[model samples]
Target: MTQSMEDFITDAFEQNYERIRLETGRAVTPNIKEAAREQVLLYYRRMRDVADGVTDTEVKLTLPEQRTPQQRKFTLEGVVDIVREGDRTTMYDVKTHLDADAAAGQLDQYVQQLNLYAHIWQGLRGEALDETAIIATRPTRELRQALRSGDDRVIDAAILKWRPCLNIPLDEHAVEDTVQRFGTVVDRIEERHFMPPAVEKLKAPIRPGARQPFGTAVCANCDVRFTCDSYRQFRLQTTPGMNPERVLQDAMNEYAASSEQGQWVDANMETLNRDRLPDAEDIDRGDV
Candidate 1:
């Protein structure tokens, strides 16, 4: 329910790092807040190698004040974590996953998001980025051990575990495709159309072992599942005669994972270290 360390690092670091990053982008450089500056310092120390060739961090495609202009231009708004701008612009996004395979499966989404940044860059700079990269940071067992014990070893292991990937960069065709894809979704929303990506529930006992049904990966974090009629119907008809107690247990599990905003959600914003990553080399990719 809470934000992961990965998310926290991204956000907190951005808030601090952007002072210098944006200043370098603009003419008049301003001082960043103290709290934010500390985060930036910690990040550079922990992940020093990534600091190389890093022209900028926390670059935003659409500023809050620029929204009207951006929407008027029918643009996609996004943030690019790192940018190496020169004869050719290179973009990078930071990702955190359990492993390389888990990070690999999310390629399409990352590519599309990066493409939005490319479009924004081209609109402002008159040229598109040449390529994009993903910097996936996955904690290993030893790092987990270091984390649990708050040992200094975590600082070094974290740097060694980072995985860099060169992915398909945004081109003319990709930008056009992105525009069309977003357009289709916008049009559907305007038309009030609906397409529930239905998932098939299994006829198993109420094990409730954090195993999300296939095709319902989105549901695992969705708050509406608590009230979704479709989910309810599927659960009732296909739970293999699970009793009321079992059903209650399933709901409790959903509550634990739900990201929907509420008071409880606000209070649970601390990251869960134990749920960071499974230790087993061949562990099934459950929502754990």
Candidate 2:
């Protein structure tokens, strides 16, 4: 019987559940939904075939049974493509139907996810992965245009960093540190502290003859859409009722306050300007 995507995800979850339980002393919530997993796996399978010049029947990932008191294990989330040639292995993320440029822009997160898996895999197998990549299954014409304009340097750097983990010894301390870091990231996300720049960035108005609409399937299905006041207000304000200027101003104010508390900048004029926006009178009255 062909294993369903949920079955694959459940297997992956089970593989890491023990470690997670030990680390957090609680059940680990499954984050990757089956739909997302299936989509990712489909892409990974396709890309792997293309890169490896082999069919799915020929490729395999050597996942071992749970062993060692402090062994690391890799849980495939949404791997879409894999290319293996001898000792060299390159994995590709299949972002089917998403804007390639947008996917490429946020490729850092994907690279990090791949590296985390690679780290766990290396711990288990005592070998390093060669490279990681993101391949858009159905890239937009504009994204293809941008790709032709320049090579992706950011992705290259992220892949390079993954190379160093190969020689790193996987001991209890290292495994603990990895788990702790992962937990911290998870905590931040749970608390919404890791929220990215506002939806305006994601929904930047498309120009004429550009992309008619600019959003991915993930964005469409995002649970936060209703909760995200900005996105909700943006949609409601299709006419003149919704004020983009006010939305921007409020976001800027919130950002400034957070920045000040975070101490993300040195005491400087630029920081001061950000902290203090010009009042209407200060601007029109030439109070500068």
**Number of the predicted model whose TM-score against the real structure is largest:** 1
lDDT (C-alpha, whole model) for all candidates: 0.53, 0.46
**Which lDDT tens digits does candidate 1 get at residues 1-288?**
123644665677656554643444321112223333433444454555556567778776752222121243244666666645457667777654323334454467667767766767777656556787776554434444555676567655654554444475565557656666776766666667656554343222222443434224345446666566566656666566689568746865756444433433342332223224565653755534
Give the total clashing residue pairs for model 2. Answer: 6
Q: Which 10 successive residues of model 2 have the least lDDT summed?
A: 161-170
Q: 1-288 in candidate 2: lDDT tens per residue?
A: 225744665577556654554554443112223334434443333333453353232223343342322344333333334456777765544455554544554444555555655555556656556765555544345433443556666333333322111121223344444444555655565556745446565455333334433333244445555456655454444435557676545544543465553343443333355446689989899976
Tell me how many clashing residue pairs each candidate has: 0, 6
C-alpha lDDT of residue 180 in model 2: 49
Clashing pairs in 1: none
